[model samples]
Target: MSKKVAVLVAGSWGTALASVLAANELDVVMWTRSEEQATEINTQHTNTRYLPGAELSPRIRATSDMEAAVADAAAVLIVAPSSAMRAVTHQFKPFYTPDMLIIHATKGFETESLKRMSTVISEELECEEGQIVVLSGPSHAEEVVKRCPTTVVVASLDKTSAEAVQGLFMNAYFRVYTNRDMLGVELAGAFKNIIALGAGMSDGLQFGDNAKAALLTRGLAEITRIGVEMGANPLTFSGLAGIGDLVVTATSQHSRNWRAGSMLGQGQKLDDVLQSMGMVVEGIRTTQAAYFISQKYGVQMPIADQLYHVLFQNRQPRDAVEALMGRDPKTEMEVMKLETWEQWHS
Candidate 1:
């Protein structure tokens, strides 16, 4: 018999992953926080609220009981939003075992402690670093659930574990790459959303493609800066987790950060935009956390700082852009310092 795969959370990303696992003939059980979503997935085989018109596989079971979902599962994938990740991990603490492969599909960090989702999972679940894996990239739940062509990276400090996750998720249309730099993967995943928020602000300001292009390039610099400082491989940022994810997220109309940024750019209130998203826009909280981390680590993250003001300080998006543009110009790599090959290794 195929291994039972327990996918936690019923959000769009969670449902989409459950669909993928079920299609691969794994016995998939999805734990939803809402009974309505559970009923929809189990009875209707649809996640109408999040991914409208997408059909989920009937093999995927839905439940609210944490223990029932994780029991006897071969692998457990945590797909809850970053904000809820801590609570979700606590709920699963009783069932956690070292033998089960744990994969976190969340892409952001905790706002309070600025802890990465996988970090929070490892600490809360009482597992070692090698026991956790992060699967991230340009994957949009709306597209992946529909089997649209997509690619992502499965990263862990343990190469074997990363490969294990890569093998399970890889298919013809959805390709998976493996990386050993868990720190880089998570940082890229969390920081790209900050850039997407900036991109959304530019779009909201009715700025042309040129402005958006500059933001993306500079944002990559900002992302790489903090990532390398935090002991991540600099090259990882240039891969699927970095530029690839940033391109898809910042430009895609489906991105929640972009949508929220657009509203902010148009002078709308943060609360109103957030209320409309319904689901947590990971970038909003991440912006604050990353902003704090950047300052604490002395990493130059102008984009994150600007977005933090826009989201938290009620700064006008247009004014924030002007402030960035008005800053002193310097060599591009001045902040990144990724010039010499030895600097990367050191």
Candidate 2:
């Protein structure tokens, strides 16, 4: 019998992954709250609203019934948005077993609690936090659906679980790498969206490549700073989940965070931009969380600070740019001299 994999909440990324599993000869079942979406996937084999112009494999199926979706499934992937992570995991409480491999591909922190997706999953599912695998990197749903070459990193303290997920998702077009620094991987994945949004605003303002180059470099430093303060390996910030994800997100047209920021730069109101996006711009929520996190950690995240003001304080994007350029001069290695850096190494 073929192994069954259950995917929660069939969004663009989830559906794209479902296609990958189906192509690999696994029986894929997607659970959606909307019966209409479930019917569309089961009968039409396409989620036109999310991933248009692509056909799904016959091995893929959809169900609105949560229990049925997970029944006998070897693995259950939780791809719910950060805001929905808790409620969605609670839905799994009735069905989850100790042996079911749990994986999450969601990026961004829980806005209210500022918790990583893995932490929230473990909390709701009553499992050890180390057991949940986090799948992240530069892969975008739009490109992955077209069979584009993509690579991602999966991290877990449980080495065997990470290897199992890597085996489950790796294929000719999709490659998976394993990283032991799960904290860094999750931190990088969540933090990059903020930089990507900043990058989009820069481009939208027509600030050119020089500004973007500087933003990305400094943005990475702060991400690493906060990650290190939170007990992550600094080297992980240089890996695929860090630099690789940041570059792709900040530069790609496929990034919703970037798109939202671009619209903001182009003079659109937040409500208007979000309405037009028809999707959750995770970075918008993430920025608020980042603001609180930086304060708590005593980490100086200048770019994130500026973005938080521009996003929530209604400070003009142009003013944010000016503030950044006008900052007092400091050595480039100042990032290495933080108290957290010294303490972390000590």
Per-residue accuracy of model 2 over 1-346 as CA lDDT, tens digit each:
3399999989999999998888788999999999999999999999998999989888999999999999999999999999999999999889999889999999889999999999999999999988899999998999998899999999999999999999999999999999988999999999999999999999889889999999999999989888888888887889999999999999988999989989998888899999999988889888999999999989899999999999899999999999989999988886654665666568
- TM-scores for all candidates? 0.97, 0.97
What are the Cα lDDT values of the candidates? 0.88, 0.92
lDDT of 1 by residue, 142-233 (tens): 98888999899999989888888887888877899999889999999999999999999899899999999999999998888888888788
Top-lDDT structure, candidate number = 2
The per-prediction CA RMSD against the true structure, in angstroms, equals 1.4, 1.6
